[model samples]
Target: MIPGVMEAAVLNKPMDIELKQVPVPGIKEDEALIRVHCIGVCGSDVHYYEHGRIGRYVVEKPIILGHELAGEVVQVGAGVTNVSVGDRVAVEPGVACGRCEYCKSGRYNLCPDVVFMATPPVDGAWAEYVAVRSDFLFQLPDGISFEQGALLEPLSVGMHAMIRGRVNPSDRLLVTGLGPIGLLAIQAAKIYGVTEIYATDIVPFRQDLAIEMGATAVINPAKEDLKERIAELTSGRGVTVIVESSGNGRAIPDALTTVNRGGRVVLVGMPAAKEIPVDINTIIDGEIDVYGLFRYANTYPSAIQALGRSDIDVERVITHKYALKDIQEAVEVARTEKETSIKVMIYPQL
Candidate 1:
């Protein structure tokens, strides 16, 4: 039997998390109730817990903050038919309004009124049970664990980055940042048949993770000159494609110099500064194509298929795990332990 109420980790204010008893969310006619098994601690979740906001989205009230989640369906609404009770599934956090122009064009990630889970106003899947749109949930095969299911959210971003950059088999890729997204981008590039993949990071741990995740070589930009390294690696021709996931303003300019003429640059990470200086001359002269990536659209199905392959193991990115009761520590680790932590996961049912 489903309980009427459940325990939830709510962010009351900046640096404050409370475990409170809340009524289980009632589902709409087209929704399904999921018993959340695993939820990944995202960078945005930590930012909200630490500063109470990300850009314009502010925490005006206490809210549950987790978006990367996967679980089993506990119940389904009358109109729901996509998934049934007892099915393990991965929930796509963004529920875009299908009537919008962006959604009609199949670019729903740009939906102006997208209700993304854990993005300020929308309460997310950090609780024992979460109700979500039935269509947004994708069934997870037996080969894919709940942890890998949760990771599909970030992995979708990596996949979207490759899509935006128009990644091809012949491309020599340069991923500037070995964070979760950058490492996953390497895997995505490899999946797309790109053979020569190079990655960069300032931290030694992430650099090591880059190689483990499928990078041909990892460059520590702090210790070595990134431009010189890229030049030597590509035999002075520079990389054919660049995916900038570091979100560091300084790295943007450096990455621009390492790409070959007519290379594609996909900006996946949001930089702290609203505006940063870039070389317009390089972009014009080199005829470089730059693409900005928002959240992913229509990537859940492919992400599931990709992660389900025996060869693609995204679980390796997980560095820490915690039960929902210990969400405070989980957020702290993701926030302060940048050097050691990559992805922190939480099990709400534990």
Candidate 2:
């Protein structure tokens, strides 16, 4: 018997995501049919809707608009075994080619042949049910909410950033953004034992939220001089590590200026323009370590481990929630980049 078709929010064009009835996605022999419960609205999804492009991936056809997902396994394929029906799970969206050199090097996130959800023509889990490979689904413990499960996708990036920075106890860490990613990085750094965390943001609410997230100090660059504040905070020596999550061109220069000699800087944000005037001379003179991120790898397990600990309450960063019916508004809210809105999620069933 044929299954029921469900309504999926498809990207029709720029500023347009229409609800279309798509056939229920089929499951492979090693796949499972999942009923999506929560899907986080990613920044890339908003970019694709507003500009119809993200880097070189052009939206030539209508595509679904979600990737960060938590769902229930409704049906398991004949060969599936990792998860059973009724298991709540978090879906890791990327399916990488195992034979790639990057994959063999344990850095599969850099795989050029990876097919990520919500990127261009790839349809994501923005509908009632999706067929996904069982290996990509991580079982959700009863103690964890589906929403938190959805958040792992982003939180893992933050965790990976901290790991990439090799954050140590009592290290002065400078985080130069207060978006959801930035906030999570704060929490990740806190858990990793960064003694004094300093945050910078133009948004007042974001700066306040940063303090709440365990920043020792919050600086508003719009109101304060970044270099002066860093110098004052560190007594002119500078921080040990910096995480540049703002994607603002100015933030890179400030990050370089704020770091101590031989400090590490990790860039997680994408700029409006890919080119940023990073003072290479300052980096060279300071002997700074700079790292670039492309999503994450081997970090989800740590994110799940953190969620189970109960020491860090990450859901506080969720400022708004939307149902599938309100997805258009959800994307629009994300685009506004308002201080009141940090991270937004779309619950298709709600």
Candidate with top lDDT is 1
Evaluate residue 70 in candidate 2 and report its C-alpha lDDT on the 0 to 100 scale: 93
lDDT of 1 by residue, 1-350 (tens): 99999989999999999888999999999999999999999989998999999999999999999999999999999999999999999999999999999999999999999999999889987899999999999999987899989999999999999899999998999999877888888888877888899998889899888888888888888898887888888788779999999999987877676788899899987899998999989999999899999988998888888885666778889999999999999999999999999999999999
Off by over 4 Å in 2: 1-3, 235-237
The alpha-carbon lDDT assigned to residue 214 of candidate 1 equals 83
Query: What local lDDT score does residue 276 receive in model 2, on the 0 to 100 scale?
Result: 66
lDDT, model 1, position 25 = 94
Per-model CA lDDT versus the true structure: 0.90, 0.86
Model 2 Cα RMSD, 1 decimal? 1.6
For each candidate, what TM-score against the reference? 0.98, 0.96
Candidate 1 residue runs with Cα over 4 Å from true position: none
| lDDT of residue 343 for candidate 1 | 96
Q: Least accurate stretch of 10 residues (summed lDDT) in model 2?
A: 1-10
